[model samples]
Target: MINIVYRLKSPKFFEESIDEVELDGVIVRPTHLSICQADQRYYQGSRPANILDEKLPMALIHEAIGEVVFDSEGNFKSGDMVVMIPNTPFGEDVYSPNYSYSSKFRGSGFDGFTSDLVNLPEDRVVKIPDDFNLNVSAFIELISVAYQGISKFTQMAITPKDNLGVWGDGNLGFITALLLKELFPKSKVLVFGKHQENLNLFSFADEIYRIHDVDDDVVVDHAFECVGSSASQSAIDQIIDIINPQGTINLFGVSEYPVPINTRMVLEKGLTIQGNSRSDRVDFVGVVETLKQNPQLFEHLEKLITNICEINSLGDLKDAFDKDYISKFGKTILKWNI
Candidate 1:
């Protein structure tokens, strides 16, 4: 399997060129293939300094649900559908104390899931239930993220009656809203996005609007930031304006640069703030179990995936990533025919 590799800040389809060498005590297969956001970014020249130093070029596809075609150990068998989790941990680097879910992340300094036939560590993959659809099952990572946000606020001193608002109606926001509604059945969950078209995508929002509609006098109990941009900082200002005293604001979205936050308002309101990553193992398993027992509960998510890209080769992969036409819809996928 000729797979994409990142080296020296460049991404290329390297064919069986480096398989003869050993990497960090692990032998790699030359026939590997996979595709995901990580791969696209690397392919498009987005290289972090740390990754460049480590020579961290590997298969990239973190959000993947596929069948295991090879099993060196008895722990997995061919044809078993599984979700691949990245082995990269937050603690691997000296600067990871503040990161969330330090345990397992699929992509970023780790080999990803997009590959035609890539070798996987035995412990890095988890078997999906027989009834789960691999395409939909691939969304587990995203669902786990939403689960984490919901879990954090619920752990705080608030109940189902607390007022809740999510800023941004993107995939994360919608998922968080749905999760919040489940966790806090009675809380008012509103979604604010830049556009009304996005609001239509969220079936869980109690109310949706543009930023201009923000009522300066209204008090919100729970607020979430989902857009990972400096604009998210403005969300902090809005949170301070709308939240009641002692309310909580969850900063889920992150920006590349440090966005200015209103520290004084936070101090004055006595707001509880938190940053949540992926869900805990218990919560992850529980979400799977709940979906298994009540499959219909997540029927809405099926529609959320509005785009699917069947990746056959690097050309196909590049087209999907570069051409706006392919990504205009919601979630996109690269189906590997093994």
Candidate 2:
């Protein structure tokens, strides 16, 4: 079969190549691919030059859902919809998924799932419910990251807190806060964001506060920082200021530069700071089960998808990435019918 792949040969340029694909393994056609900040950084040439020089000329998408076309092993039947897990671990490790030193994450260290058909090992693909929306499944990889972070948080948290806080109203913040609320329904979830319009979309949050408007009296037992990039430090500062003593701060964001944290305050408060990245199979299974059990949660997650651009050609792929780059809030999904 002819497989056409969209590769980033240079900044702002995607070249396509036609090649034959081996259908011996599980062959899945990517139906929906979501653009992540890391993908954008590669496309826009914002990443460090040395890293870009090494990783460019590669496919640029990791978050995606696909339909099975062929599975030689018969583990998954044709026409089954599945979410792709991008992290491919080479060796076993007792540590978490992202922490595994031998892991190869797609769209970063390896080519990702943005292609005509993805041939993955049976273990890297998890089948989703037939009734589930493919658009929402496109983001399951991201949602699983939050699931993994929260899972770690639950394991490490010393006590149950009635209140939680999420910083940054971006997609990660939105999903993290929503998942927290769903998992802990009775807890009061407070969201802090700079943009009121973006904060408005977070209706699930018990209270939304503009970063500057957050009162001094507001206290949270735990906090999550979702604002990555240059704003990560500021968000961490705010998280430290309001989080109660001995609170756990989950760092879910990615920053290109070293973010200086207040070590003095962290030590004084006896806080626990944990950082999370890509997720594993356990997280993927948990997220899929949660979506199947709670239809309403799936609907709420669908609201986070702001743009769905269809990719029919190389031009369409460029447009999808470009549109996602300009989008202020929500996720941009590439409908890969090509």
Candidate 3:
């Protein structure tokens, strides 16, 4: 089938390309898409010039939900609402394909969900309730990332989860803190951030504190650092100082450069640091099941949708990215009218 793919030909520049999509699997029409920090890095040319040169002219946006347009073998009916999984794995293995070198992730090096229609493997799409919030569902892939991290932490941590601290007040931090509350109801969920306005949105958390305002007496049994970039170092440092011994530190931040770790403190405190990246299919399934069981999660997730731009052309798409960059908090959702 003929498809229209909108790719970032250059920084702040997009061009359309004509491609033939094979009918080997399911074809989905993207309805709602969300902009991510990684997409912004490419749009703003913040990545190293060499890396940009290698990956540019690629279609962006991996977090999205769509309507099923076609499904081979009739496994799914037409017009079914489904969340498209971006991680295309080769086969099952002991380690997750999301962390494997063989996997091809959309919007990073491979083409994302920006085309007129996406022909994806049947296993890559999970059906969602038709009535679910489409805007919130657009970012389900992101929520799965947090789910993956928390799942790993719960499975490996031998210490108490009495107090859970989440650093950074952005979208990821909000989602992590909220999920922690839902998963560990008895635990005190504390959120630490610099932006008062952003931190205010995490109303579900048991406690909120400005990073600098945190009392010396306060501490958490575990910490999650969601602040990426150079600032992640600061959040990690603060976490190291306040986290209890044998605590698990979950790192979700994506930094271009390496963040320094106080190994002396890490050894003295016996902290376990785990790095979290993109999630696999199981994480997506778990998140979907969780959402179905706790329908109220949509209400909390709705607060993260700050900008909803309708995309009919490349100009509108550019406008949405520009708007997302300036906004201090929340997600910029693209209403895919194209």
Candidate 4:
């Protein structure tokens, strides 16, 4: 089959290429693709120059939902809606799937789901309910990231906490806060952001506070740092100050530069900080099952999608990326039906 792929030849420029693909496994046509901050970093040349030089001329979308066109394995019927798991492990290992050193992830070192048709192994895709919206389903991978972080926190957290703090108003923070509420309904989930306007969108959070306005009396048993980039350091500082002693902090953000932490405070408080990156199939399965059991979570998640642009041509693809570049909040999704 002739596959049309959008590749980033340089910063803010894309070239379309036509290549032949073997239809051996499951063939999926992308219905919706969501641009992640990491994708933006690559497109804008914000990543390390060496890394960019090595990984450019690559397709740039990992978070997506697709419709099954054909399945050689016959595990899924034609026209089935599925979520593509971006992390493709080379082989089984003693460590966790995502932790495997030989893992090949789409949109990073390998081609992603930005092509007109993606050929994936049956194990790499999960079927969703027919009634689920594909646009919202595109966020499953991102939601699963947050789910994985929380899962890791549960394993490490020695004490149960009633209050949880999430920092950042971006899509990651929004999703993390919502998931925290859904999974632990009794816990008070507080969201701290720089912008009140953007923070207002987090209606699901138990309490929303401006980072500057948070009182000294307010404390959290645990915290999640969803603020990435240069702002991550500040978020971590605030978490260190407000989080209870012996608290476990989950770092879910990505920063290009090395972030400095208050080791003195960490030692004095006996704090534990854990870092999380891409998730595995089990995380995806957990998210799907949670959404299936609590469909209302989907409705709440829809609020995070602030913009959706249809990509019918190369021009449309550039426009979507440009719009996301300037977007101050929420997730920008590319409707890839074209």
Candidate 5:
């Protein structure tokens, strides 16, 4: 089959190319795609020159839900709704495959779902209910990332999880804190962020405090640092100071440069800093099941959709990225009509 792929030829530039996509596996026609921070970095050329040179001219979306157009194995019927998994893991390893060197990621290592049709293995696509909200479901890949991180954190942290603190007012922080509250109803979910306006959106949180405004008496059992980039350094410093000794510090942020940490504090406090990245198929499946059981999450997840743009042309796709860059918070969803 002929597939039309929309790739980022360079920073602030996109072009379409025609390619042959074989139906060796499940073929999905993407319905809704969500733009991620990583995608914006590629679109804006914020990555290192060397990395950009190697990764450029690739499709720029991994978070998306689509309809199964054809399944070679008949696992899914035509028109079935499903979420595409971008992390392609190969080889058998005791540790998670996402950490393996053999893994190939969409939008980063290869072409993403910005094409007219995506041919993926049957196992790579998880079926979703027809009644599910396609817009909110678009970012299930991101939700799975959070789910996997939290799952890992819970498994490793040996201390009390009474007070869980999430740093960052952004989408990841919001999602992490919200998930923490739902998963740990007995624990207090505290959100610390720089923007008051962003923090205000976490009405579901037990406590919301501007990072600087946090009282000295306040402390958390563990902290999830969702703040990446320039502010990550400060967020980590604060987490080290406010987090109780022997607590785990979960790091979810991606920083191009090294964020120096206070090794003395980490050693003295005996902190366990865990880094989380892209998730695997299990994580994706867990997210789908969780969303199915708790439909109320859709209402909260819907708030993250600040801008919804339809993409019927390359110009429309470029415009969506520009609009997303200017937005202060929330996610920009691309309705993939193209």
Candidate 6:
């Protein structure tokens, strides 16, 4: 199969006749690839490592939902819908000494899901429930990050508390709020964003307020910053301003550079800061359980997916990155069905 390959040192290359899996022991055959912020950085040369190098082209997609066409280990059978959880095993790579989040990301430094087929390993694939929506399930990896962040929030209290304040109104922000709503039905949630157009996209929150318009009386027990930029610092500051004393703040966004934060207030409020990364297979399983137990939580997921395109060759692939087209899509997936 011909696959879209990201060569770190050179331009993006599509290679044909290569084996389905890399020699490093990672199984993958690219299927659908989303141009995430990480992909964008790689394309622009902002990120290090030569993608053209054999190691870098290993593939690029981390957030993917697919079907298990084959599994030699008998862990899964053909026709099972699954979500790929990319994580490098211990000792697999010299850098995986601690098995941190960076060790297992496919698209981060290896081959990704932007190809016609991704031959993922059994352990990397999480079987989705028969009734789970594929499109919504694509957000499972992301939901894991949200889940981890919120899970931290639940841990801070001797008793589980639910009130949450979500900062930023991007897809991550919206999805995090959705998971919070489903996971903690009794919790009162508030959403803060600068753009009404973006804020209006989500309906999960009990109340949505502009950053400057946030009410002073509402004290949240948990807060999150979903936007991955320096701008998020302001959002964090806002979150700290309104959260109750000892509230936990979850920073789930991917920031390419460092941003200034107000440590004094964080200390004064006895705040707990938490950061999360792509989830594990266990996280996917938990999310599937949530979806199975509460089917109604998916009611608005379809609204979150804005576009899907089929890519046959390199030409169509370029169109996939055309900022004009992708900007309008909340989740733009390059489908390799053709």
Tens-place lDDT digits, model 2, residues 1-338: 78877788999998887768887878999999899998999999988899889998998899999999999899999999999999998888797657889899999988888788888889889999989988888989999999999999998999667999999999889999999999998899999999999999898889999999988799999998899988999999998988899999999888878999999999999999999888999999999998888889877788888899988888998888888888888899888878
Worst 10 residues of 5 by lDDT: 89-98
Supply the global lDDT for candidate 3: 0.94
Q: Could you tell me the lDDT of residue 104 within candidate 6?
A: 43
By summed lDDT, which 10 consecutive residues of candidate 2 come out lowest?
16-25
Question: What's each prediction's clash count?
Answer: 11, 0, 0, 0, 0, 27
Model 6 alpha-carbon miss at residue 184, Å:
0.9
lDDT of each: 0.62, 0.90, 0.94, 0.90, 0.93, 0.67
lDDT of 4 by residue, 1-338 (tens): 99998899888999988989798889999999899988998888988888988998999899999999999989999999999999998987797777788898999978888898999987899999988867889989999999999999988987667999999998889999999999888999999999988898898888999999989799999999999889999999999999898999999888878999999999998999998999988999999999999999888888878889988898898889889999888789889966
Look at candidate 2 and tell me the lDDT of residue 190: 94
What TM-score does each of the candidates earn? Answer: 0.80, 0.97, 0.98, 0.97, 0.98, 0.85
Candidate 5: C-alpha RMSD after superposition = 0.9
Q: Which one wins by lDDT: 2 or 3? A: 3
The regions of model 3 sitting more than 4 angstroms off are 91-93
Worst 10 residues of 1 by lDDT: 22-31
Clashing pairs in 4: none
Give the 10-residue window scoring lowest on summed lDDT in candidate 4: 91-100
Model 4 stretches with alpha carbons more than 4 Å out = none
Q: What tens-digit string does per-residue lDDT give for candidate 5 at 101-191?
A: 8888999999999999999998899999988999999999999989999999989999999999999999999999989988899999999
Off by over 4 Å in 2: none
lDDT per residue as tens, model 1, 192-286: 88867778877666777688786655566778888766888877778778877777788888565788878898899787888775543445565
TM-score of 3: 0.98
